[model samples]
Target chain A: MKGQIKNTLKGLMVDFLFWLYLFGCLYYLLHNNWGWTVRNKFILITAMFFTGLFFLIGDSLGRKSFLPTASTNRKWSHSVWGWLLVIVLIVTFLVGWNIVEVNPYKFFTKFRNAGGITSGIFDPSIVGYQLSNQSLEELKLDGVDQEILEKLSGIIGKRYNTRKVCRDDLKRILDEEEFRIYGEILLSKTEKNMTMLNQALTALAETIFLALLATIFAIPFAFILSFFAARNLMPHTFLGNSVYIIIRTIATIFRSIEAIVWAIIFSVWVGIGPFAGMLALMIHSIAALTKLYSEQIENIDHGPVEAIKATGASTIQTWIFAVIPQIISPYLAFTIYRWDINVRMATIVGFVGGGGIGLLLMQQQQLLRWHNVGLIIWLIAAVVWTMDMISAKVRTKLTSM
Target chain B: MSYLLEIRELHKIYEGGTHALKGIDLNVRKGEFLILLGLSGSGKSTLLRCINRLIETSSGEIIFDGKNVLQMKGRNLRYIRRQIGMIFQQFNLIKNLSTLTNVLTGKLGYVNTIHSLGFRRCRSDVAAAEKNLERVGLLEFRMKKTRNLSGGQQQRVAIARALMQNPRLILADEPVASLDPATADSVMRYLGELNKKDNITVVCSLHFLSLARKYGSRVVALKDGEIVFDGLPSEINEQKFKDIYGEEAEEVEIR
Candidate 1:
């Protein structure tokens, strides 16, 4: 009698939870996505009541119905349900379109406005002026000869023969040693230099290292947590089950928050720099890698574990000898893959004051220096491509080994 | 009688209440080679695992080496396991590890937790691992990973691994079932040698009657979770075989 009552209570709880979940989903869809204002109590209640009534009618009709032949009734009802489903799908799609506010005509009208920025982006400003120690204005104020000044202007203007013309002009005007110094100064000042290129390259290197550090920092933490999270390894005892639940819950929560959000949070805590970005990536990587590594652990061969246990080995010993061997290759593969993802994510994290080339890119973009932004974008693409290739090759080798 | 192991009134019911072993009473003398013959899922593996307390028995008393195995826990259970080695159909060697490392794992029971964590093997243990590999004729392949070895060679490495424990008994659950006939016979020959020369009591499960007849001094047949036949290998007549294996069953020779 007690058991029966207990089962009835359990069933009631499950039903209550199910209904709660259904209503929660309905409320979310209506309030967030339906476009109709559901803030008024009367409209909300009326809508919910109609939806519940329709659901009940559908559910009842889906089972037995009033008809002479049950088979024919089922077939007929199936068609009605199918048509209703199609209509519902069409309504949902239309509603989704309205909610997203997609405007195709705006693209054609706005295309002209974006032409300047697009052109600047396409024509990357890869080179910049090689500034000398002294500015041109300083030399002008120093009251140098008018011919020398004209010659300097000529050297700066003409791109093709600037170096040769300046050398010949200055050599004819000045003595040999003074001509050499002037030539050096002129060439240094007017040469097409790599200021933008160097900045982009440096930022890219910082981003790569930030990603590498994040992956490396996350490894041991993920490796240790994975054992607790794995269903097959943990959850045998009450304490183990609690540990499993806690670790799994924490990992899921961490993984759900993207690295960029974490970077923003860390930037507040640590002050904006690569350290914040690296910390954010490290936290996300730990969670993601814990999930992957635990799954790998869960899928490992039970045979070796059993064999090891039969050898009179302790639980820890079995893990070391049997479980560790099976998971090492896959773990290495996953770590390398995580590093690859971190490299891509680091660039994004930098947009939010978390340091890397992305910070430079964002600054240049806001200043409307599209050419500098383009150089940084190209550098990021190249570095990301190279890292992807290297990581893929390494992962293949690890897995094969 | 001075028996190496004793099992009384053993009953095993799985999680979903499948009765795998029902009221099994058995004893093993020292230095005996016993073969268990039965169809798949006839409780052979369960019985073997229960001997070492790998699978907890539903209700039974298992006494191994004069100690109550079922009553043992933690350190006691692990200590008991060290004396009883087990082999599986898949060989169950750590595939990514070298043959020497797989063999060295057998001595993990004797090592402390700290030592095991560091994977520190004693000189004696290393020497014994090499000796065991030599005994299995796998000394040359000790440095090779177990996955690269053939099925027979892998099984031999598993045997060498078991020998590292210096076990008094070995429980083999379909050890040669996946190997070819020639490899099966060769593997069986090694087990036979261990039984005779090392005086290690062995309880092995087999699918083939011919291999049982050759290596097993005594054969026990289970049908529907109950022992249907238990006698000398020669005592299994066609009628008895039919009774144990069902009327539709026909013996298929391995060779």
Candidate 2:
């Protein structure tokens, strides 16, 4: 009886930890000022609801009953169907949240009216002038003195005169008008910045293209190097050991230096452009992926190799039949994982003049346009999250087969 | 009858300065069921594996089918290995693969690397694998992963895989050490039947003396890497085995 109580307490502790982790992640998401979209609210509520439902079921079923108290049911817990259900639930929740939160409509609409007229029927500059003039009249009616209003009207009139105004005089009049309509003018500038949304989209597209190009060049090189890096495949000799050590050391050195640093170095060599970014990402990816692929190769079972060898199969044939099949799943998984990482790194590498979304983000930061910076951050997050979900699905489908 | 395998002055020295096999000489007649009996580290397994060149002998001339296999290399070595089938104590089937695939891998020597990588085995190879599995009474379990089967079933699959090789010689290194007495007897019966029916040569290393006597036509005893006794199973009386293995032989439960 005492033993049963101990087991029950242990179960409760584990449950508490799981709930704590879930809530902790949610807390961080909210604290990061990640915005209060409908998706976020749904995730928060769903997580809470599940936590409650799981505990209720556990209590009704008798904690030990839900867990595998006997060995026979342990097999059931480890079954493919059980794992599939859990994976499906998690993926459905994640993808659903991502789709709703990253609704492209909101992103595109935010910048819809920035620099261009939405309908093309009227110019924004002409509209801005009319709106400013109307706002001035409204201020006058709200008990503003006529002297101040007349001064504001004169300043605006001087700035927009058709005759060429002296540059110094125009600058002085613009400054006075800005001071008079401080809050209103600031809001109008923000709205105008939104119209230049195409710049952000172009930056995102360029970064994605660079990432894909780097991955294409890196995967093959990494695959070749992994053959020498695997310990089981290499001979038990000084030459083999030295070759493995050298390749491993070189890969480690490349991977250890951040991609951003690589980009800065490449930018100096090739001058500024996406070419420098691609080279940087390629070097880092080759290093990282070689290590990953080599580990996969080493962990493959030696049984098939022995079987092949006993059948008089050549060394190359043995590798083809025995080694390749075992490692294919891991290779696909690692490649997709690398691509996801490369996309994120490509943006960072752009900060060094390697041309991507990071370039626009830096510009916005320099301009102190926090609202525009917020929009860019959201767009980047959305793209990365979408890619992550797609890759996860692909990985699941491949490995199951 | 002409000798199918001959080993002369076989000696193996480890890098750590331990002698695994002292000077040893033996000859196996064609189509004979020979059993090497010894306790752990008595060099029975080493002697069996040495025939296929799985482990290199330090100083020896191993002549298999009139060819000095010790001096063979590249294509020649693989050609010899293909004719000599080997089974392990662990059964050593690839756990993740189905029984049919594991059996089919025996024909890897005949298939090209490209076909193997593409998983494109010839139709005949597939049929042969199925036939071998049926012989082992595991045709219905061919699609199941090897790990899902019991120990006896796995050992049967291993034997089926070996048969797929159509080998001239089958080497079993402690094939029944991991099984229960009943399973061991059944496995030995199958191996004995194969030898009698197909006239194929077999060299099995065994720890159980009674089992060796029950199935083996000839017993080769090794003590400390030296061949202490070699004769018909009936000639290997308890007194003779005692002389070779010393007082420790009494502790061995032959039953």
Candidate 3:
């Protein structure tokens, strides 16, 4: 009889909480979207009246056994609560539509704003002007003026040079100086393309290595932290439980923030470059891999642990022999998966001055050099594809073995 | 008779309020193959684990080899545990590791932390592991992963692992409960041999009466956390079996 009363009280508390939450959401929606303020006493009173009436009706029906019994094969859609659910869903969708200000016509209307970039991408500037290897002294003797010589000095010779000739200078150098163009333009375009390709390849290599270093750096930290975070491995004592919670909470917080956000903060701290990018990725990967590795630890077979402990193995020995053996395959699989994600994240980190092909791509994009942007994009896609294939193959092999 | 193990007023109450062991007292003599027979959840496993301090008893006195194991902590407890090896029904060998590594893990109690960290077993330890494996008839399969071995083979590997401890007492917790009838007999034969040859005090739990009678020197039957019968294996008649197992229980033949 005491248990019955306690159960009834618990059910009443749950019902009250359910009604409070439902009304709370309704009030938020009505006040924000329909201008129904708290001062609107009449509407508020009517809502309260309906809520009370509904509960009273339900209570009375339940007491009198008027509601459909569990044995009855009632169709859920035909129920009153079902209709209310459908109404709530439709109202939420309508509010979402208004909030986002959905307008499909603007897509077609505003598309031409992207016309210049689209055309530039369509005619990718693959060909570049190959600068002559003729010495500055030779150019001066060839009757080239000192000003033109200085301008040409910035664009030529250094295969890894970042500077490119401006439009006006390029036209002047190519058109007005008939002597230079007739001798240079035909053969130099391929050489110029080669230089661009070479730059792309170098940036690609930097991006991959940056990702590799970040994954490698994160592994040891994550591996050690995972033992603390794993619920099964941790003791049920107060200190152990607290440590588990602290590690889990920290990991969750780190993982919640995107790698791009970390990159932005790190780029500021470390003053930009692949190092900052690697640092950002490493932090994110440590948190992500900790969560993965700990979960694998939790799912390990308890029997081996029990057996090991029974053999009078010390904590460290038990971990090495029993726990580590079971987790190695899954840990390797998670590490490879994290490395794959880090590679993709490395390219994006560059957008925030974290440094890689993304930095080069961002610069080209801002300068309206869409063709160079297109080239960087192509290289990124190819590398990502190859990485995807390799990770997939390795993961399958690890799991199968 | 020298008592190898002594249990007095051992009571275990789980967090879920399960009165699994309710005030038990028993004494085990040296060189005795004591077979524990009981229904599932009758505290057979609870008693075995308590001997090695595997499961912390709520309130009890467990004296193993003249030392009060309940009061022992850290190194002392490990020392006591190493002298008492345990086997399980599931044959809990590390499946991903080779049979040799699994056997070597049994010697973890004696190994220093540095050697364990590097997973470097001494040459003598490796030789002992091989000898133990050969004793279990698994020396040829030492390089194979335990997962690739058959169920019976896996249990033999578990035995080899236990041998690495050089235990004076072997606790078999329903070791052959998962094996076939023939395999179960073969596994018990190995334990019987060890009991006879090495004079190891074994406290094994089992559901099968046939295996118990054949291998056990004495049979101890428990009913609802209290011993109902303690005598020679030949003394467990039909009436005694019913008293321990309850009215509706019928003895099922393994063969």
Can you write out model 1's per-residue Cα lDDT over B1-255, one digit (the tens) per residue? 589998999999998999999999998999999999999988999999889977888998999999999889889888999999889999998999999999999888788878788767789899999999999999999899999999999999999988888999999999999999999999999999999999999999999999999999999999888898999999999999999888999989877
Point out where model 2 deviates above 4 Å: A1-213, A237-246, A268-275, A378-401, B112-118, B235-255
How would you encode candidate 2's per-residue C-alpha lDDT over A201-300 as one tens digit per residue?
Answer: 8888998999889998999999989988999888789999999999999999999999989999999999878899999999999999999999999988
Which DockQ-derived CAPRI band holds candidate 3? medium
Candidate of highest TM-score = 1
- Arranged by TM-score with the best first, the candidates are 1, 3, 2
TM-score of each: 0.85, 0.67, 0.84
Clashing residue pairs, candidate 1? none
- Model 1 scores what on Cα lDDT? 0.83
For each candidate, the DockQ is 0.83, 0.33, 0.75
Query: How far off is residue B69 in model 1, in Å?
Result: 0.4
List candidate 1 stretches off by more than 4 Å. Answer: A1-81, A130-189
DockQ for candidate 2? 0.33
Task: Judge the docking of candidate 1 as incorrect, acceptable, medium or high.
Answer: high
